[model samples]
Target: MFVRNILSAIIISVAPVSSVLAAGGDTPPIPSQDWSFSGPFGTYDKAALQRGYKIYREVCASCHSMKRVRFRNLEALGYNEDQIKAIAAEYSVEDGPNEDGDMFERAALPSDAFISPFPNDNAAKAANGGAFPPDLSLMTKARANGSNYVHALMTGYKDKLPHGVELSDGQYWNTYFTGNKIAMAPPLMDESISYEDGTIETLDQYAKDISHFLTWAADPYMEERKRTGFKVILFLLIFAGVMYGVKRRIWSNIH
Candidate 1:
């Protein structure tokens, strides 16, 4: 009887502990698709992309990697070849095997791919404490309504701890990261990277361009594809309308 009573007490104690543990762990609510930042179907904003590139270069590039994208590819975004080459030359890429049979790194060429920040997967994980910052290449498709999600995640970290919760130093909670928590320390700070061209401080514009860039990254052909589709759809509707009128004219004779 004493043992049964002890077990019941233990269960009671553990239950509340578990409940308390669960309560504070809840993530901040994510905005719905109806929200302003939810859609990816938008035109690329040049000024915002320029600002985002500045952010990427000054802030996020230190730890994260975008090895898939070549500096030259930025030319598609309207950068000149000389500008692209100059940018590519800024980074030293991993390379090796000289006549002496030793591995040596060389400056990245315009034609070469961007270098991964970490040497390899193990190194990346070890450095980041087992959380590798995700590549931005396909991040648009990787997350739901990815553009706004990126923006929200950037601006979402809070100074005030939510009830029953604690945030670790240098760790942040993002409303959009899967599981609502992330190892990446909040990367953006207002005026953290200044724009010479005086853009608004609001997150909406920043989020919009980054998402647009990622959308283009996911499918470079998207604009052409969408344009072609619209043309085809319009043509088909016109054809259908013409056929319906012809049918109506034939039916009038019968009537």
Candidate 2:
């Protein structure tokens, strides 16, 4: 009985992976892109983050929410207090009741979290044909190889369907999404957004920018963490060298 129970647990775990492999057999591997913030010493590209924020605000914000991010967090992307306030004011958020005891809506403040496009999940799903757009705050952290996954997903749409494949009404075909089917339609196109700094406005560039931005959003403290780690390692090495020298001198005198 115990052996059977172990077998059942193993089967349950392996079943999902096997099913995924079967469903995604035709899907190409997600390609890794060179990111400015990839290595232990790597830091975020501030320009990319700003561009990414622009994309998020203008494009993805219509469907997805960055609930974990606050407007003041734009400081990391080099936005000044005034710019952040202006950006925040463009959106409205639900605020506390007045003396009348009624909830009210007001201009968003820098301290407020990013407002959802929909008031709730059901409303979001209703708007998107029964598909709930996910909050993107922790998206890069939630998925395996999330940055690459997001980039691939954003650029993987196909207008032509493979043989024997058909999409349901709201579904679209993507080469990188699991089962080659995704609820969200292709959300980007060439020249969809114009960059004042003259960055290329291609789909691939848009994907890369948004992926970089989401990665930063998921781990804003990555550079600080890396710096602290380097400092700790350097201190440990110096302490170890000092201790070794002290041991050698003490042993030399004893001998």
Candidate 3:
């Protein structure tokens, strides 16, 4: 009976692994990246985050909306109040009901979240061949190995189609995307945008920078969380040591 129970447990554990492998058999492994904000002590690289923001602004902003992030949050990327305001003012956003109870368009403020490029979902789909682009605010947290997946998807476009694979109109081949077909065309190219900071402008670099930025967006308080965790661990260790000494004193007296 014990042997049968042990076999059943082993089979249960192995079944999930088999199902996972079967479900993702067609998907290629996402290559890992060495992000600055990866480990327990990891912190976001401000320069990379700024560059990533620029890439998103110039390239990805046409389709993707990062509605969870406000223009004021650019302060974390080292932007001052004036710079943030200037950035915010570049975009027009919809604002409230006047005395006439009608919505009005106005220049965006620092407090305003990044606005969607399209007014509504139907409009977005109409613009993109009936495919709605996903919002990017929490993309890093929404996917498994989110940073690596983002980097892979960005750089994984292929010019030539694989044998036995054909793409429909408005679809492109991506080596890393599931089922190997994606709606979005290649978004990044070498030297597409010049950098103020003199970083080389390449597709791979763009992917990395954007991945880093998105990760930071997904978890802006990672550094604070890690710091707090370290403090808690240190306090626990000290308390444990003190308790051990007190127990030793009590036992010593008893003995």
Each candidate structure's TM-score, on Cα atoms with residue i matched to residue i, is 0.76, 0.89, 0.88
Number of the top lDDT candidate:
2
- Name the runs in model 1 displaced over 4 angstroms: 1-22, 32-41, 96-104, 168-170, 201-209, 245-255
Worst 10 residues of 2 by lDDT: 20-29
RMSD over all Cα atoms, model 1: 7.0
Those runs of model 2 whose alpha carbons end farther than 4 Å from true positions after fitting are 1-26
Best by TM-score: 2
Please report the TM-score between candidate 2 and the true structure.
0.89
Ranking according to lDDT, highest score first: 2, 3, 1
Looking at candidate 1, the ten consecutive residues that score lowest on lDDT are 32-41
Q: What lDDT does each candidate get?
A: 0.69, 0.91, 0.90
Q: How accurate is candidate 2 locally (lDDT)?
A: 0.91
Tens digits of per-residue lDDT for model 1 on 1-255? Answer: 999999999999899868855766544455533322223444455565666677677767777777677777786677888888888888886677888988888878888966677878788888887888777877777877566566667767776665655666556766555555678877776555666887775555555555566656665566566678779999999999999999999899784
| Cα lDDT of model 3 by residue, 154-186, tens digit | 999988876656678999889888777788989
Q: Could you give the candidate ranking by TM-score, starting with the highest?
A: 2, 3, 1
